[model samples]
Target chain A: MEATVKIFRFNPETDQKPHFETYTMPVESTDRVLDLLEYIKGNFDGTLSFRRSCAHGICGSDAMRINGRNYLACKALVKDVGLKIKVEPVLGLKVIKDLIVDMDPFFEHFRSVMPYFVNDEPPPAKERLQTIEERERFDDTTKCILCACCTTSCPSFWANQEYLGPAAMVNAHRFIFDSRDRAAAERLRILNDQFGVFRCHTIFNCTIACPREIEITQAIGELKNAISTGALE
Target chain B: MMQTRVVPQRGFNLDYIMFIFTRVSGLSIVLLALVGIILAMVMGARTQMDLGTLMRWTFFPNPNHVVNSDIPDVTLGWANAYWSTMQFLLIFFAFTHAANGLRMIVEDYVNRGVGQLLVRGFFFLLWLFMLITAIFVVLSS
Candidate 1:
């Protein structure tokens, strides 16, 4: 099938303003959008820039706005997007180049949530033990690959950049619900900031945009319930 | 990443509950107000009643007058009961929605610390006072 890909192009050093460029190429029905991008870069425009690692969906490095929604480039099939695909860098981030968004802000929020476990007790004689039930509590959120798809799709983040976006909240939910984690109270307190979990309006955009299929909104709701009922403490 | 220090557990923060209540009350106000307005408009059109009469009916619902009027007493009583219930709900939803909205705005824009707490507390107390006053007036009428 023939596909016309419209890509947003800009180089801060050379371009006065950003613009779109169209490239028509033959693509197989099974070809993913990332494959088409690779063909464009290799054959038509070597200057085109995008981020991709592992060429699979796991790395989550190639998340961008495809046809006005955030998706992992490697995961979206060209056939599914129709003949004309409009691509751009994800919203609410600094666009370094075509289809590439600076992820520093997203990662900064993730870090602020204290993504790692903090157990004050001395290390057990062996690894910490958890029952299967306890492990299942937060298993869903562990699938997040640090992709900014959910955060970028969030309207709350666009309105107030200071708000800890849904992605960070998901990560916090992962740790806060863990039975062995001792920092649940501290994590909850940190999230009690004015820009924290309460900012989410249950819009479900993050839940839809998540590539990992994690129930991001449900996790945030759990956090809200915990905070309201004092269950986390 | 810096390790987070465990803070002393403070039981039952009302902020989240207040937030949820504000949202629910706001939605209820919108839906209830819409129904009330539509019902009023339909009744006014059917009865050929002007806005003045409608306003008077809303502010002063007299069950005794309805009972003695030519209209069936049972029907008029039902109507009066409905009107009183609607009025009470409108007062409750309106007060809670506005008060909660003000609290949210203050918390979002104001500085975080004792100042925000004081302002929110003041708003809560004011809301309670206004709600009590409104209920008293509604019951007396």
Candidate 2:
């Protein structure tokens, strides 16, 4: 199959504005978008820039807006991307070059939520073992990979760059519900800020855009309830 | 499943009341303001038209022409301010209320996982987006 990949191209330091560069490549239907990109970079154009660690979608390095919606290029099939595929860096992010975006803000928001466990209480000498039932409470939350596909797909982030975004909050949720972790109050206080959990509109776009298929809105709902009811207190 | 307490219920009573009030008040005020503006335009037109034409419409009820001492000049300043304030209030309340409602929806749905993390993060960003947009428009205007 032949595909026209119209990728957004620009170097912020040099180019005043971004322009689209289309490359027509003959590809097989079974080929993934990453495969095509690799082919282009290796054979046609070496200037093209993108990130990809695990081609199986575990490492979400190749996330971009493929033909509008956000997805992992490595996971998306080239034949599936319509005739004219427009690949651009995720929305509400600064495009450093071709398909790369500055992930500093994304990481900042992640860190702002205090993603690590904060247990002040004395630890049990033995393993702070939790019952299977207790472990199940936060079971769903531990699936996060810090991939920004969901955040970039969100329209809210498109409008406001300051939001803590969902990924950080979800990470916080993982620890918030853990029986061994006793920082629910602190985490809740942090998530209670203006740009925290309250900003989510539950549009479900993030959930849909998520490659891991994690139920994001539900976790956020739990967090919101926890914050509003002063559960953390 | 672990025996975790259910989320604290924020009943629909307050939400329903606010929704109804905003919808009713906003619609009424906007409509009334439009009517007032139109009436003022018509009155202005009548005053500017030829005396004969003005009299034709003004005298439809065989109105008493004793340029009354009891009549007060109608100034729309207070009305305009009142109406505009009402409109702004309704919009402000409605927008925030709706935003909160959607936030609640998010809390009710997204489960913890990569999907949850990415989605909630995305939602937070979106909230920030709307908030900033609202602020910018409010401030610049």
Candidate 3:
């Protein structure tokens, strides 16, 4: 299959603004989008910069805006690009190069929520005993790989840049709902702010864009309910 | 280096307080509107005043009377009562009701980027102005 990809190009230190450059490639039907990008970088233009570690979606290093929607480049097939592809850096983020964005702020939000299990009590000799039901509490949220496909797609994060964002909220939910985790109250307390869970307008874009298929909006709704429930109690 | 932390709980009491206030104010507006409608119906348009003029008087104190009486009696008649009731309904609901409503709209129209921001911004400003005006009138009265 033949495809024309209009990729965004920019170097912040050199260029005043980002611009698009097109590359036409003859690709195989079963070839992934990342393969076409590699072909372009090697055969056509070496300046085309993007991040890709694993050829599969597990690494999550090659997330980019492919035809007005964010997706993992490694998983996206050339056939998925349609007639023409207009690729750009993820929205609501500072683009560093062709398809790379400065992930500092994105990870900063992850750090801000302290996305980890926090139990006040000391660990027992073995470990906290748990049934299947207890383990299922955070199973859905444990799928996030920090790829930032969900957060950049969120409109609430676009409006309020300081918003804890959906990815972080999902992480917080993972820890908050854990049976072994004893920081539900503290997590609720942290997410009760104006730019926290309440700021989420319940737009399902995050959930839809998630490569992990995590139900982000539902998680945020649960967190909002938790905050109010905690406040009342 | 020592780590600094800020929790949403620290500043969240105010949001909760505001949420409660907004709910109370919203309910009060509805109740007041209902009362004004009942008052208008029961009292009838006895005074030789139009609806708009009457509404102004209910919200704004009547400047016409300058009686040297000891106790100044404030009477809210039909026209004044209904207009003020409508104004209160508009002001109180505009902020709390409309702001939340637009948040819903933003959630609905996700793909339209600049258009959504522009419309939401306009609604937000309108709500802010109406809330301020409503507060001013209520305090003055």
Candidate 4:
């Protein structure tokens, strides 16, 4: 199949404004959008830049706006996006180059949630034990790969980066509902600030844009419920 | 399946409080409208007034709205202190609910710094002014 791909281009050192560069190439129906990018970068312009590690969607590095929606380039099939595909960097973040965005602020918000486990008591003989039901309470949010797809697609996060976006809330839900963690209240306090979980308008954009199929809006709702009713079960 | 792992409850800030208040006040406004309709029908509105008059009283519940309608007398049923209180309550809920909603929208963009302060101050005064004027009209008329 013949595909016309328009990839956003930017070079801070060379150009004052960002622009788009189109590539017309023949690709198989099974060829993914990432394959098109790789082909373009190899044969067309060597200066094009993007981030892709593992190329299998596990690393969450190839997230970008594909046809106005957030998706992993490796996972987006050329056949699914039709003959014409428009790819750009994710929204609401600074594009350092073509498709590579500055991810430091995103990671900063993720780290603010205290994503690690916090149990101050002495260790058990082997590992912390948990029931199946307890594990299922937060099983959905554990699939988040910090891809920023959900956060960048959120209107609230786009308006204000200070607000703790949906990704951070999902990470908070993971630990806050764990049966072995003891710092749920501390994490709740951190999220109870002005720019916390309440910032979410429950528009479901984050839920729809998640490539891992994580129930991000529902996770944020659970955080709001926990903050209001103080219930983990 | 219960609050086995409980989050410590603390006094929530204005945002969470307003989030819950928006829901409660929204329901309260609906209930108030229903109450107004019931009272209007009970006082012979169904027989004595048209649909426009009945609908007008359903929201405002004032004598001025019904005075020029098919209803002959407006001294006792629709023009008393009780109806004035209802009008005040309706305006209060609707205004406060909408004002807080405006703040929620503003918080989406301006959560910090001078812009936040300016929007907060400006919208608050606007809400206050509108509310006071509504209250005066409700009581005087």
TM score of chain A per candidate: 0.97, 0.94, 0.95, 0.98
- Which is the better candidate, 3 or 4, if ranked by TM-score? 4
lDDT of 2 at A198: 63
> Scored by CA lDDT, what does every candidate get?
0.79, 0.70, 0.72, 0.88
The sequence of per-residue lDDT tens digits that candidate 2 reaches over residues B1-141 is 454533333233433344345456667645654554454346553343344433322222111221223344432222343434433443444455555556445544554468756766776677667666644433333
Candidate 3's residue-wise lDDT over B1-141, tens digit each?
212122234345645555555567777766665655455445542343456644543333232221223324424342255455566565665467657656555645544578778877787787788788775665455
Show model 3 residue runs off by greater than 4 Å: A231-233, B1-11, B14-87, B96-141
Two-chain DockQ for model 4: 0.54
Better of 1 and 2 by lDDT: 1
Candidate 2 to truth, TM: 0.65
By how many angstroms RMSD does model 3 differ from the true structure?
Answer: 9.4
Candidate 2 error regions (>4 Å) = A231-233, B1-141
Report the Cα lDDT for candidate 4: 0.88
Error (Å) of candidate 2 at residue A13 is 4.0
Chain B: TM-scores of all predictions? 0.58, 0.33, 0.43, 0.83
Worst 10 residues of 3 chain A by lDDT: A224-233
Q: Judge candidate 1 at residue A18 and give its lDDT.
A: 98
Question: Candidate 1 or 2, higher TM-score?
Answer: 1
**On residues A47-70, what C-alpha lDDT tens digit does candidate 1 reach at each position?**
999999988899989999899999
Question: How well is each residue in A69-90 modelled by candidate 2, as lDDT tens digits?
Answer: 8889988886677667788888
Q: On lDDT, who's better, 3 or 4?
A: 4
Misplaced by over 4 Å in model 4 are: B1-3, B37-56, B67-76
Better of 2 and 4 by TM-score: 4
- What is the fnat of model 4 with respect to the true interface contacts? 0.58
Q: Lowest-scoring 10 consecutive residues by lDDT in candidate 2 chain B?
A: B57-66
Task: For each candidate, report its DockQ versus the true two-chain complex.
Answer: 0.16, 0.06, 0.09, 0.54
